[model samples]
Target: MSKRKAMPSGGSTAVPTTGKRAARPSFEKPRGFFGLSDRATTWILAAVLAVWAGALRLYKLGHVKTLIFDEVYYVRDAYTLLREGHERAWAKDISKAAFERGDIDSYLPDPQYVVHPPVGKWVIALGEWALGADNPWGWRISVAVLGTLGVLLLFFTVRRLLQNTALAFLAGYLLSIDGVHLTHSRTSLLDLILGFFCLLAFYFLLRDRDHFRDALGRNEGTGEGFGHVTGVRWWRIAAGISLGLACGVKWSGIYFLAVFGIMTVLWDWTARKRYGDPRWKLRGFALDAIPAFFAMVGSAFVTYVLSWSGWFASQGGYFRNWAAKNAHASNPVSEALLSLWHYHEEMYSFHVGLDSTHTYAAKPWLWLLQLRPTSFYYESYTYGEAGCEVEKCSAAITNIGNPLIWWFGTFALLVTLIVAIAKRNGTAAAILSGLIAGYLPWFQYLDRTIFQFYSVVFEPWLIMAIVFVFALMLGGHAASRTRKRIALLAIASLVVTMTLMSIFWWPLWTAQVIPYDLWRAHMWFDSWI
Candidate 1:
């Protein structure tokens, strides 16, 4: 008789015992009407959390009427994307007052040189197309909507990845109130789109991993390698599409593509070796990894090409005629391709050489600690102006994260990192992999102008790490009820503290007119100033 043990929900296969395969752990598949099962419950709870997050982001969203920080670039770029098929140059005399008041009829007729791709601007353009482009609310609506959807997506992803409903909800709730997340969602910026798309891609890849594992489990001892687990991997293809869109928003997303693609291949290799397949590496490479390349990298390539349709269709886009004019290519299509490559080369040059100093620019090392929080907007209003009744008042929108979430979250990441290295905890590795993908690349560009607010791109993974720490505190399902209750209380207190911190700093997150002293109170450190 085979000795059996229960597998924790959302965990990988059991570790190998000496000279023998470990007993396969049993899983419980809960069933419901119409075959919904756990998914039905997850969707309902996720919906509630998403609505809560969306409400907070959407509340008084238009309070700050002017473009804040980088919004001056994106909001105008979005409108330009709509007015012209691609980005267009602005006249030196373009009026900020008239532009904000919905008058944008005087842009130059030539294409403009832009570093980033067009997808995110197109997303912002969608909101401006529906609502008038003149208002702050219109330009920011798309980010708020995607940010809310990202919260729900994170919940579903955690539930699927961990197989624990409680952990999933905790992850989503923490993200819902995160100051950095809320600030990005309410602002018209490209980073929110980049972050949301990266999370979406990760969610798809996680689902793909589950599907791969389920295939292996279903056909145990049946194949030399992954030969018996031939299933249509739609999820992997979707991940590619999401990653491509992420890259289309910002070049930084390429890091996720490379990291996740390599990770999936390694997973296939490990699964084969665990199942006693001879020549596991070769089979994993030939049989699994090759197919995955087409599924992920190939799909991503197609999506990236399609994202350039606007620039391709336009006759007057920047460098659109470069190959014909300078490179002297005869075929129009070939010329267009050459022009696109040239444009990318120029963009790459700009990224590598961007060392201009800015007040809020920070090094990647300081980002993890959030030593300098970037201020997006600030205005001093005297009494009788902007409804200020105090002797001196300040209205500001600062992109600072909730201290409890970030500070404590950093500790959680350290713990998870140790577990991943020491015990080879699959859950810890999965969470940390995302953290590294979204972050580490920034270190190479230390001399470039980067801000602490960019940490929002990896903030979801940080929250997930915190949730894993909570799971450890809960002592798993085997813990005594009394112990579980105590752990739950501790987790609840931390969450409440995070929420209160958000409220305390809410005025800074939103440009609410508060007394100068009150605003200063929210700035906890000199660096925050």
Candidate 2:
């Protein structure tokens, strides 16, 4: 074969140039829509997640026909909102008939003034509206749906973080089996809504990271030392909104907004450095980080205020007109808004100083081990009453987590902290930060009467931390097949253990009619009972 004419000494060779390959597609986009491609494997995993989350959230959803725990508060508040334009007080017996015959008018017309924001109550109202007034299922259905969505969001979030389908599924599976999550899902509670929003904010921030990095990689000008990209990331904006909604659900969510916002900015700074930018640190802060802070935190503030729409509109809400009556008045509307804010300040003060004794109060340090899970509902039943099967039976629903998951997961978090400090792994650091955002702040209130069940807000992130460490243990994709097998077996064992523990705890968490002896049998520790 005639070799291509060697034109000159420095001429291009025509021997097909096989040694130097064509530029490979960027590692940034690894298949699928937002990496979710039409691969059979992806579809199969999606189907599996759908079934897992659905089964956990939907099975025996109405087992406890009566209100359970916090459901009594949220369900009633929701019904009142549906009838009156604001929350109203209800008679003690109203819960018995409020669901029947649409008699929600048992509530007073004046605003009853609630501590939590109304968005969660509105969410609860959706189920009540759909199923009508008298159905317990109606009140709980929305929370169940939101809790299930949290699972799926968690799956996607972990999938993005770990870049492994198996690890993502492990996180989702652990969350599904968590007894606290199960109880919260079965009841109408604001914390579950807060949890869902927190997870969503995390998911959106992940999306923002991926998109921002992809944008940097694609911009040829960036290679020439561009200072910063001014692109408006819709994903980051959505994350801001979600973080705000989380805060609206509970003030604790502000911690997430603050931490994740900082986390995203740091991630951008690092991405810039990794791409060989010279002034990455300064430019990342001045251009990328500050704007991101505004988008996330500022937007969250606005969203949180918006959640008080009813309080703003109604004249009878507590403190709604305080500013008007006091010297703080500027204008009627402005005064009313200021008064509402003053009310929040007072509430915050109360929350911070709450050192009163409570039967189920727990220190933040003991929360990880569930040393004092709150008993949401408890009743001792006599034979032939309340479905008692023996001489004396018990029906209870405790907001406790699966012991295997919580204990092992907390232990895994300790390992993750060590690894992050020693190895400086970015993923490990990120997972730890999320857990801290949800948990560590509670330590500031150790003297306050915070219950262990409040840990539910951050429980999903704890599970994520566990899976993240497990992913690290599994080694990289190039690891030996034997190592991968061992990792899989270990993870499978953890899951199996968690599932069994969940089964044992299910009756107590759901108030099923079980013999008092059986209930006691499930209570592995005196603290748990």
Instruction: Count clashing residue pairs in model 1.
Output: 0
Candidate 1 C-alpha lDDT tens digits along 45-89 = 877897899998998998888778887777787888887788888
Number of clashes recorded per candidate: 0, 6
Residue 208, candidate 1: Cα error in Å is: 1.0
Alpha-carbon error at 73 in model 1, in Å? 1.3
Best by TM-score: 1
Q: Pick the candidate with the highest lDDT.
A: 1
Global CA lDDT of candidate 1, please?
A: 0.83
Q: Which lDDT tens digits does candidate 2 get at residues 1-529? A: 3322321111111222232321212332224445456365556766787788777777777776766666778888888777665677776766556645556567755556577777889889999899875777788899888888777878778877766666777788788878888888878888889888888888888888878766676664434444555478788889999988988788889999889988888888766655545566788988888899888888888898888787777777777778877789777777977897898988788778778998888888888998888888888988999778689999888888888888988888888888777766667777877787888998887678888877888887798888877876787656899998998888788788778888888788777888999988877788876
Clash pairs, candidate 1, are none
The superposed Cα distance between candidate 2 and the true structure at residue 93, in angstroms, equals 6.8
